[model samples]
Every structure is written in C-alpha cells, then in structure tokens.
Target: MLRTAARRMQVRGYADAPKGDEMALTFAAGNKVFYDKKVVKQIDVPSFSGSFGILPKHVPTLAVLRPGVVTVVENDGKQTKIFVSSGTITVNDDSSVQVLAEEAHPLESLDRSAAQEALSKAQSELNSAANEKAKAEALIAVEVAEEVVKAATA
Candidate 1:
C-alpha cells in the first residue's frame, strides 16, 4: 500500500515532499491500534475547542477530542473518515498524530438507524433519571449517540 501511495504521489508531483513534510497517523481504541502509523498528508480531528485540521510539522500539542468524525487524508489523496466516541489527540514533534479514542469505527460501518434509536433511548433515560449521576451519564450517552448519527449521515 505504501508503494502504491508512493507511485501515486510521484505521478502527482507530490513525491518531493521532505522527510518531515508528512505526518504519521495512528488511531487507537483502548490498547489496540486500529490504524497504525499510516503516512497522511492531512488529518482533521473534532476537539472540544473546535474541529481543526493538522498538517505536517504542526506545533506539538494535546487536545481533548469530542465525539465526532475524524478524517484522514492520505498521501495518495484518499480520505478515510471514522466516527470517534470521545478521545485524546496528540501531535508529536516528529510529525506524528495519535488519536486515543474510547471507541471508534469507520463511517461505513456505522448504522444510522441504530444510532438514532440509541439516541432516542438515551434521551428517554436522561429525562427519567432518578439521580444527578444517572442523568449526567445518560446525557453523555445521548450526546455520543447524536454524534454517531451525525457522522453516519455525513
């Protein structure tokens, strides 16, 4: 796959990017790395601050990501979108972007109807919570479900 991407980059005149001109991206759920260190030209993450795009050599920083879609644009211009259920995003000095998500799945794998149903259930639970703690948890669940539905439809 790397060879294929390199060939496409060469054909597009993008093969001249310097060593540090590309970012290696990793998406992990728990201790499992779903996508490991794939070379990408760009990545967009949904953060608590706001959604933002990262390019190679971006200033090193850490962000708390919200439940939303994470988009990766590869060297060959192929874009992959995943729905992330909250996480932390870290940009390393070596032009590496790592996302540690509580849960994540490719957009194509998402079931919009299921997500909508979950959203409805969670909302109902939130409205009928017996205590503050339960209410908060239900609220978070509803938010996550809503984000999943949005990502699936997007």
Candidate 2:
C-alpha cells in the first residue's frame, strides 16, 4: 500500500482510483504498474484469451486472468507493463478496477536471468509431466513462469 497516493493512475486509459489510502501492489516478484494523476481506460489480459479493457460506466464484471503483460497506455501515450500470474479481477462500471492475483509483480523490477531460469525450470517440469493432474499443474506453473519472464524481459 502507498502512503501518499495520487488522484489517478492510468494505463491505456484513465485510472479511476480510490481516495486516500495508497494502494500497495505486490506479487511473487515486484510491483511495476503505476497510477498517475490522469488515466482513463485499462486493459487486463488474462492467460486464456488475451487483453481486456475497462472504461467509465463499462459494467460490473468479474474476469479470469492468464499470464501476460498487462499493457497500460497512459493519457500521454506512454505505455506501461505489469506481469500477472493466474488471478481474478472485479470491476465496477463506476470506474473501479480491483485486481486480485495469485501473483502480481512489476516486470521492470524483476531479475531477468532469474525469471528466465524460472521459466526454464517450469518448462522442464512440464515436459516431464505424466498424468492429467500433474500435467495440468505443471502447465499452470509453466504458464506463470513464462509470464514472469515476459514481464521481466519487457
């Protein structure tokens, strides 16, 4: 959580933020996404499909997320990135985006080689997996690990 929170933090659009309490974002890695004073639209890409966005008066919704870089284009045309593991998000059309993830980190803050190694390790496990359950779990690990690598390398 942040101590001195800004009025807004935008990615692809304006970020309608909470008042006062500085949001403390965390993940298995680090926090890189930012909320500036002016932002409007935001897209959170889950693992399965891709990128999804939210705007003012969009609607109330819950979405499952996948591993990918959450691309945020600020109002000034500056794009930002955040790496998310398997997670879920709750959004209200009123301009509130609540992201709850099993893992959330800033790609910019991660160690590139470490993440790459994690991806490699997960891939090895995935390749060696036998049976449905093991394969499924390994697949998830591999996916998250790959996402971490993407975030770190981005």
Candidate 3:
C-alpha cells in the first residue's frame, strides 16, 4: 500500500514526501503572480456555467469565471479561499491550473466593512448610471463588491 511504499522510501532515504496526484495552481493578475506554482489536491472555481472542481489529470478546459470565491484545497486538507472579481481559468494537459483574474484578494485579508462600503457605493452609482455602458460597468462593480462581501463574511 501507499504507507508501505512511503515507509520503504523513508528507510531507503529516498525523500519521504507524501505522494499523490497533485496539480500545481498558479493565480495571477495580468503579469503579476499572486500565487506561484503551489501543489494542491483540487481547486473549486466559480465558472460562468456554475461552480466546478478541477483535479489532477482532469480534462483540459478553459472556463470564464464569475465574481466569486476560488477555493484551493491542499493535500493535507487545508483550504485557501480567494475572492476573484472576474477571471479565466485554464486547466492544462500537464495538470497545471492557471487563473488570470481581473482582481483578486485573499478572503482572510479583506475588511468586511470596506467591501460593504464599496458595495453600497456601486449600488448608488448603478442607480444613477447615465447610459447603458455606464450602467453595465457599475453593475459589474456591484457584482464584484458583493462577491467580496460574501467571501469575507463566509
């Protein structure tokens, strides 16, 4: 079994690391890397079609993200949650997941009050939008701010 193999590797001094089907997750904003190649068990993404999970050896896919939370689960059962304004997720054949977000922040680091204030402001702007384009932009801002609040509160 896996435990026996691990024990043998340890006894042989062959680098006793937990072995599993791990995928590297990279979260980025434009050219800036928010999270480097961190090996994870799975990633929960909020795609336009709904929420989906990506695991190692998953079929290669590209998905448009909505304003919501992206959860990265490590092999040890620890979960990292991030709020993404909007983005695209690319699952490559090599079991690497790349996320390109318009804006993203760790849920644990966000101030709920600030997110609430931004949501209120965006809502007010949306109500007073002068044109269709302006209204669309304001709507997007409202959506992003709402997502931040939801993630922060969760």
Candidate 4:
C-alpha cells in the first residue's frame, strides 16, 4: 500500500508540472511584425486595468493596453522594452501571448528632447482645440506624448 501511494504521488507530481518552460510571444504593430512566435520567459504590460506580469502557463487573459511601456523578457534573461501608443494583449491557454499595437517603438530609440517637445506641442493643441472631437484627439496625443517622455527618460 505504501508503494502504491508513492507511485500515485509521483504520477500526480508529473501531471501537475508545467507543460513548457517558456511562452511564445508575438508582437505586431499595424502591418509590421516585431516578434513572431518568439519564446520568452515573461512579459510586463501596462494595461488599462493595471500593470501585470505574464509568465509561462499564465491564465488566459485579454487586456487593453494603455500608452506605456511593454517589457519583454527573453529566455536568456535579456529584456527588451517597447513603448506602445495603444494595444490589446491576448494570452492564450496554449502558453502564447499576442500583442496587437496601434503604434510601437523601441524605448532605446526614443529621444528625450524630442519627446518633451512633442508633449509641449500636444498640450498646446489641447489648450487651443476648438471642438470636442479636436479636444479629444489632442488629449490622446498628450497622453501618448507623456508616455513617450517617460519611456525616454527611463
């Protein structure tokens, strides 16, 4: 009976083990594909609900991304940060993550001075907007610029 119990415990442990050590990540911006089926260790996303970290075997989730940075951690522990203007992140049950972004750029490529100037211009446009639609557009621009500035500084 003790041997049988030990065998059952070993089988359960094997069954409970994670399927894989890494998750597949696909990051796309409009017509451009940044990472296609790339294996990753983790991903940190800025969502409208809040920032969350995704790892292998994460529960299925769909999140609307805010204008902020998305950090992708590769299997080798190297991290890549990309600033996304807006996006939707989908985590599948099969250990895959897909990010569809409206606009995205590497954080290292951002210029702090240029981002600051854009933020100032967006703020000025928001102040001078004549209609509700224009104001809304300017507000979005301001938010994106602000996030860009933050990413550049970081």
Candidate 5:
C-alpha cells in the first residue's frame, strides 16, 4: 500500500510562504492556511499584554496569544467564532495572520457543564496560589477557561 501525504505541511519559516498571491494561515490540527476570504476586514485577538487587531497591509509581526475568542466577520456581514485553546498568532508580511492553536473548534460543540466545572476548579487553584507568578498564571487559566465556557454557551 502507498502511504498518504500529510494532511497539512508544517510552516517552517516566514520566507518559506507559498509562492502565490494568496496569504496563508495555519492551524496545528488542520492543513488549511486561511488566505483571502470575504467578510473579515481584520482580526482582533487577545495577546498576553492586551487585544490587538490585524488588518490587511499591516506589517509582519508575531504575538503570543492567550485563550479567548477568535471572531471573524465576512465582507458580506456574516460572522463566525471559534474557541482557541491557546496558541501563537503570526502576522506575515502579506497581512495574513496564522493562528497555531493548541486546540481549536467551533463553539457549538464545547461542553458547557464541563467547561464551567474546569473554570471553577482553576479559579479555586488561583485563589490558593502561594506565589505571584503562580497566581498570575492561574489567573490566565481562569480567563481562558471562562472564555471557553462562554464560547460554548454563546
């Protein structure tokens, strides 16, 4: 039997982008690199420091993202959202944002009760933290978990 090719290729370097007019965005579990699409004029996501928007023609930049909503609006006014467990988003020279997620999915399938329970647990852990760094990390976890739950129920 012949072996099948990888569903997606791992993006190596920025310069190695596919040679075409289309921009690329790659998620870890999917081979799809989101390129030109309608509806979305920009992408706004939560970074470690704060939220920022990535728009067409923006210069290349990179960011460490936190758990939150990935909202997209089509040029025609349609919108969709997904819960990104956690990941890094890289803005290429072409104005495309690549989201490398730890895990990702549509909000519809998330388990609300489970996410709520997890958020509760994380909150309790954060309250019991014995150090500053640990507390901060726990706080982030709580936020991520809460977002997940919200996305699920929203």
Candidate 6:
C-alpha cells in the first residue's frame, strides 16, 4: 500500500516548476545598495568576455564586468543606464541577478568634462609612471576613465 501511494504521487522537477515573468536584480557599489531585489524585465551587462543580455529563466552565469555602461530594462519598457568601473555579475538559477561593482554612477550624474579631465590625467600618469606597479595602476585608471568619458558623453 505504501509503494502504491508513493507511485501515485507526482513529482515535479526544477525545470517543470512555474517561473515568473520577471527577474529580481540587485546592484551594489561599495557600501551602497542601488537596487535591492528589484523586479526587472531584462539587464544588459558589459563583461570582459563580451556583452550579453539577461532575461527571465536565463542560465546561471558569473561574469567579470568591464568598465562600461550597464542597462536595466524594466517591465514597463523604461530603461536606466548606469556606469560601472569594474565588477562581477552573477545570474542565479532562480532568476535573480546581483551586480557588485567597485564604483557605479548613473549616466546623468556623470560629468563629461570631469571624466575627460580624469582621462587626460590618467594618460599623463601612465606616461610618467616610473615603476611597473605605477604604470599598471595608471593603465587601469586610463581604461576606466575612458569608459567614464564615453558614458558621460552618451
């Protein structure tokens, strides 16, 4: 009787479970939490490997982000663009995405002129760097500053 009852019960696999139309997104920079468990339709991320879009039921992934713009598309079709210096993005099987960035700012908050000045300073430092460590740091600064300038102007 126990075996018969067990056989009569139906078991559903993870893939067979109902999924939501939206995904939860959390974006953080340093100690600040920009978006915490916000439901969104889609996310576009810039990774060192390549840029890709994340949607509901997307396969689990972990990507190392580059210095570029991250676009979040809401269910209502509204879009928000944020600039990130560098970070990691994790997509979970439960349709949740978390972005941890070293530095992040809204596109409108960025100053194009200031970003340009920083870029110039980074380049100058790269040229004047006397040690390998300094040169490496300056190179990274240049890359981040260049992205900031582009994002600010865009």
Q: Which pairs of residues collide in model 1?
A: none
Off by over 4 Å in 1: 1-19
Regions of model 5 farther than 4 Å from truth:
1-23, 29-41, 127-140
For candidate 6, give the lDDT.
0.92
Decoy 5 TM-score against native: 0.64
Alpha-carbon local distance difference test for all models: 0.88, 0.61, 0.87, 0.92, 0.69, 0.92
**Which candidate tops TM-score?**
6
Question: Per the 3 Å backbone cut-off, how many clashing residue pairs does candidate 5 have?
Answer: 5
Each candidate's root-mean-square deviation in Å?
12.3, 12.4, 11.5, 7.4, 12.1, 6.8
Q: How well is each residue in 1-154 modelled by candidate 2, as lDDT tens digits?
A: 3533443443246335544322222222233334433343445456465567754445566777787776655545566676767677666544455665665666677788998888888888888988888889888888778767766766
Error of 4 at 138 (Å): 0.9
Query: Which residue ranges in model 4 land beyond 4 Å of their true spot?
Result: 1-18
Angstrom error at residue 105, model 3: 0.7
Please give, for residues 2-28, the per-residue lDDT of candidate 5 as tens digits: 233342344344443433444444444
| Residue lDDT tens for model 1, 1-154 | 9999989778732223336577898889974576799888999999999999999988777999999999888888899898888989999878888989998899999998999999999999999999999999998999999999998898
Candidate 4 weakest ten by summed lDDT: 12-21
- Model 3: colliding residue pairs: none
lDDT of 6 by residue, 63-141 (tens): 9999999999988999999999999999988889999999999999999999999999999999999999999999999
- State, as a TM-score between 0 and 1, how close model 6 is to the true structure: 0.87
RMSD of 2: 12.4
After TM-score superposition, what is the CA distance of residue 69 in candidate 4 from its true location, in Å?
A: 0.6
- Model 3 spans > 4 angstroms off: 1-20, 30-32
How would the candidate models be sorted by lDDT, starting from the highest? Answer: 6, 4, 1, 3, 5, 2
Clashing pairs in 5: 38-75, 39-73, 39-74, 39-75, 40-73
